[model samples]
Target: MLQSFYLILCILGFVLPYSQFVPFLLEHGLDIKLFFEQLFANRISGFFGMDVAVSSLVLWTFVFWEGTRLKMRYLWVYVVCNLLVGVSFGLPLFLLIRQRQVEQQTD
Candidate 1:
């Protein structure tokens, strides 16, 4: 049941953010150079992107530390998913995996 909760969180996370990002990509032509150009075009964009970068770095650091300490399986899965999608999807996915590990240890 707890795992289900995390899975639901992951699904919502992806759905909510992509609802915005997908439209942007469609409108912007999915060009990598154009994406980066616009990502830093304004002060707000710069601040927001940098903030996300810093936060993602912090999150990954904690992920590595805790995952290593607990010998968590599929640690790379979280990292890869974070890169491919976004933190919204990856964080909850990692939490779900971590929760499963905790449950296993108790069993």
Candidate 2:
């Protein structure tokens, strides 16, 4: 349940900014290249891409864990694949968010 909520939140973080704010900026005549360069230099793209990746991982992890718990042997392959995807794309974002949550709770 908590994992699901986190996954949704992470996805929203990515979608909202891109779909809402990015389009608004573009409609207002923002230069695409300059916008991208600024975004890249400040690491915003990396941050948001990581957010999406981590959310995907969290969602898949929950799925695989549940499948395994249910004795679904066929899902082992899926688990491996999901883990690979997560590590390739989601690990950094996962770590970042996990660390943030830990810090917030500790504080």
Candidate 3:
């Protein structure tokens, strides 16, 4: 049940963010300067940008520590996903994998 929940979250995470991002990509075609300009266009946007930046760091740290402790392979995959998408995509995906690993260990 938890695994199923996590899977659902992962799907939502990827889809929800990409729903916003894909349009930008289609319109701008990887305009890094414009991206940053818009990302921090105002205080509110800057707040979100900073929040995500810090959250990404936290996620990376947790992924490294817990994943290594559990001897989980493909740790870099989570980091890459986080970079390409966001914490929304990375966190639940990591949790899903971590859940499976835990289940296997217990079994």
Top lDDT prediction, candidate number: 3
Q: Residue 19 error for model 2, in Å?
A: 18
Model 2 lDDT on a 0 to 1 scale: 0.53
Q: What ranking of all candidate models by TM-score puts the best one first?
A: 3, 1, 2
> Residue 14 lDDT in model 2?
48
The residue-by-residue lDDT of candidate 2 on 1-107, one tens digit each, is 45555566556544544575567576766676865565466577868656756766675675456544444445444335334443332433343445455556579
Candidate 1 TM-score, C-alpha based:
0.83
Which stretches of model 1 miss by more than 4 angstroms?
none
Each prediction's TM-score versus the true structure:
0.83, 0.29, 0.98
Compare the candidates by TM-score and give the number of the best one. 3
Residue 56 local lDDT, model 1? 75
Superposition error at 57 for model 1 (Å): 1.2
In the range 1-107, model 1's lDDT, one tens digit per residue, is 98999999999878987897798888987788987888899999999888867867876887898888878976788877777677888888888888888888889
Steric clash pairs (candidate 3): none
Model 1 clash tally, residue pairs = 0
Indicate the TM-score of model 2.
Answer: 0.29
Candidate 2 pairs with clashing backbones: none
